[model samples]
Target chain A: MTEREALGRRRRVVAAVVASLLVLGPLAWFWWSSLVPANASVMDMGYPDTGGGPAAASGHGHEPEDGPRVSVATLTGPSGGVPDVELTLTADAGPIEVGGRTVAGYTLNGTSPGPTIEAVVGDLVQVTLVNRSVPDGTTLHWHGVDVPNAEDGVAGVTQDAVPEGGSHVYRFVVEYAGTYWYHSHQVSHAQVRGGLFGALVVRPAAPQEGVEAVAAVHTYGAVPTVNGSTGDLRVDAAAGDRVRVRVVNTGSGVLRAWVPGSGYRLLALDGRDLHDPGRVAEQAVLIGGGGRADLEVTVPDDGSVRVRLGSQSVIVGPADDAPDGDDPRSTLDLLTYGTPTDVGFDPRAVDRRFDYAIGRRPGFVAGRPGLQWTINGHTYPDVPMFVVSEGDVVRMILRNSSGQGHPMHLHGHHLLVLSRDGAPSTGSPWWTDSLELAAGESYEVAFVADNPGVWMDHCHNLPHAQQGLVAHLAYTGVDTPYVLGGDLDNTPE
Target chain B: MKTAYRVLAYLVATGVFVQAGAIAYAWFATLNDLDGGAVIDSDWEGNLGHAMHGIVGTMVIPLLVIALLIVSFFAKFPGAVRYALIILGLLVLQIVLAFVAFGAPVVGALHGANALAILGVSITAAQRVPRSTTTTDASAPANAVA
Candidate 1:
């Protein structure tokens, strides 16, 4: 070819190359900036701050030194003395009977719903957990109790999982009188679903005279059961006897509990008593997953009062008087059920506010293909780090648009439900560690940052959490020495 | 011979554009997947992005094969042969860069940058094809090495 022609062709090629780079350079920069911020690394997303010690406050864990004096190592329980009430719980994995169905599961003390340990307020409750045959090991996490960081029982975080034939003692004072439960924290997705949980009811110092029954509802092999019984759990009650049914939902979904033949009052929720609970009839109380509700009902004159849990019944009187057919009653709305009372702190003066919108999108997680649950439109590891200083009154708005219900459970602290959707709560103070969110529902909950630790706030649906529906509520100065996905295989969900 | 060269160039250029489109789609899918904060069911989007990337990346193998066949058989089109070889070399480089990206994600930027160059060069090569042998002879030497 001619020299001039070759030069012109080369010039055109150079011009095209320059033009392409000019266009693509800016686009690449924009994409990089959007996906990875300039100052933040992928490590900032969910990796534990490995710097260690109290001086390693990098604004991620624990507030600055000038902030509130929130000690992370301090225990919330009583300072001294051996545990007043001691109990032993042995975890075993084998075929167990649940609601008449023999299924492979892990159980506590040879039973799915382990023995209910009763104690009075002001007593120190100590439970020695012995891992008998659980291959992956086990650690008991008091689901709603705000114990010290060391006693939280998150495997790899607070402490290592108790291997087979090993034991761990959890000692904490019963400061509050209400219904609570404990479950395995190691590989909890499979352990909790396979049983390995039990009820813990702490009564008031001056106990009231009544017929008390604990109805621990769970789904075994897909069969709904109340107190491990599939059918009616009969509790003999004389006429005029006041019955208090502590309904604890241990399943991964919301459960509806109601008295079919009598009116009842909701006394407490999540271990906290409601103020001036008025009587209500013909409505079922909805309890979120991992939540508890205490209902009071007086036995009828002639027949029985049946407290229906899910599809099963807890007959307070004679089973012959139990009503048949479906309960056509409407569900009760707890947001406006009882008389309003003081919540102590004003929710109006919130220090920090955050909106956590739960959504779902098709994507990949660690190379696996599926639809993933998301918080605020981002998947796990990329989820929000809700930072707060100690003593700060924080308000969080949870919105679910995922077309599915999520029982969101927050660790280390309980929150007061302020409103549902947009309506303000007018009932007695409703506190919850696990809040249920229906599809297209929004709830606003507020809580003080009293517990200074890196807490996990995730869906109670363990499988959903395994798929990535998890986030962290991080205090400024508290850093976790734990590493997820390490050699321990710690699946905290 | 001129028509055969034209067809092969057009196919290579089309492959380049298709690969570019696939990469762009994958990039956006990855963005959507990453933006899905704490969602449990959002993994499919990321998997689809990787699938598109794999499908498009594998497409280059067949495209390079066709270009090689054109150069081997159509000895008259020397210019088209050179362009085909350059494209084949770039495809190999792209594959290497992609593997390197797994270890050092920062290299992904270079992988993306190289993709634009491949697209541009393929298009330029396609545009250089002569409409007829009379025009081709005027622009190039006779009996050119393929």
Candidate 2:
């Protein structure tokens, strides 16, 4: 062939390649990536851990305490909601500083994350919510609760957003208990993101021994947190003491709470007990907003070791693709991610079977297009509440609906995973405060109606909660019309 | 004699587009039907591979062989095709490595590279139609050589 002809052919090849990228290239990508199992790396999403590399915070351990102890209490809005007690919430102003300050925010009780409410399951919660900012009106959503239709906190839907200087008394009989949370259902991404949130732990009737703690999970932009804090955590526990730590995922973040050096046995997730308590040496407890995981840890002979709380990194495998959700291996996280959990409990009987799916969808992450994460066929519902009776032995089959794996967690109730991805995890020495639900993977989680209240089940990644990947598992009062054996969900029989 | 392969390349390109488009269309349609915004927000990249898992997981393995056949016709032993296949081959490798790495940054980087590989395959497949009487390598030198 002539040199000119060869050059012309080369140009054509170049143009073809360009055009193909415009057309066939995307097509090839579609087929190779779309048509085949995702060889795409979970790490390809390129999310930077806010607390430096997760491992930088990995090896911290708690030093033994002599006698000094810090008294940590739940705060609140005028009416208890996501905050321990509900107070007048100030709407957005300039960049409001929360936690240590510097970032823009919305304030509740003059602080970000509103308040932390600590109450027993059966206590009568009397909260007077006062909204002082934003003329558009503000409403408090008792996230993870089964309030009446009129009382259900939705801006325009259930009730009007509390007006500037407007106050509403939120009185709810805390029936179902566990670590549940609340936030403004309206202007969710806006207000909640602005710092109008907190932890709500409804103390269970039969509280376990050792230490009882609350860790609220949420996201600060791309960051995930527990009680709005990352890095080190310490709760006073005597040696060999069975400590039960409660977490309320209020900020729409996933939480991984584990005592790194401590042997944390997962007691419950989503306020439900596991069929078999799976002991995790390096455990990952996934808790979304309104999701809770109870861990029973025997404070080691030593005082404490640092427990890491962060998103799980996915493991890439041969065939270049991760194990699909259906494949048991694919559901596993690549990172040695973990959070300590509660001890095991005896089961009454296998009540029923239900499944849930978690995943991401197209354009889930901004830079990353055509990506998404979801649970079941849906992610978390952006609605104010999910209605149900209290005290029911619920079995949720958690399936990771999207490509990303999520650490599924629940609020207000700790649950035990009866199975992972539909197979029996019960026999796998099951006990977990949180467990990993890989992409397209599912797990069968079971628990009793011991804790009666509204609960949340969602991915434990803090940001996931803010984006509305949070679901509510409501437990109405036993006297309610929707009783489980009768209505199939009320707290007590 | 080699011209026959040119026609085949054109056919293959056309086929890839059709299949990819069909898959994309299905994905778009399914996404549209659900309240994706309420839950997943708005991202489609993660879904494509997952939605295609059934076809990709089951069919792609077999197609790898066919893709190999197509590659064989275009270039000499393992040079061009091997380059493109490297990214494709990373799928299985990633899963295994993740198990070892515990989902750390090393595994993360490999995943990022695989995504780049997917992008490379798409570009190469589209550009193939115009080249003739030239060694058609599916991957760039960096991709191919590595």
Regions of model 1 farther than 4 Å from truth: A1-44, A47-79, A318-321, B1-146
Q: Give the per-residue Cα lDDT of candidate 1 at B81.
A: 58
- Residue A43 miss distance in model 2 (angstroms): 38
For model 2, residues B18-136, the per-residue Cα lDDT tens digits are 44555567667556744432123211223453456424423443244345334433442233444334434543453334332333456756644553444455445434434455444
Docking outcome class, model 2: incorrect
Candidate 2, residues A237-315: lDDT per residue as tens digits? 5556666666655543334454443345665555444434646654455554345666665544534433343431111
DockQ of every candidate:
0.03, 0.04
Of candidate 1 chain A, the 10-residue stretch with the lowest lDDT total is: A47-56
User: What local distance difference test score does each model get?
Assistant: 0.72, 0.45
CA deviation > 4 Å runs, candidate 2: A1-101, A134-137, A143-152, A155-157, A204-211, A217-219, A222-243, A249-254, A272-290, A296-306, A310-398, A406-418, A425-436, A444-493, B1-146
Model number with the top lDDT: 1
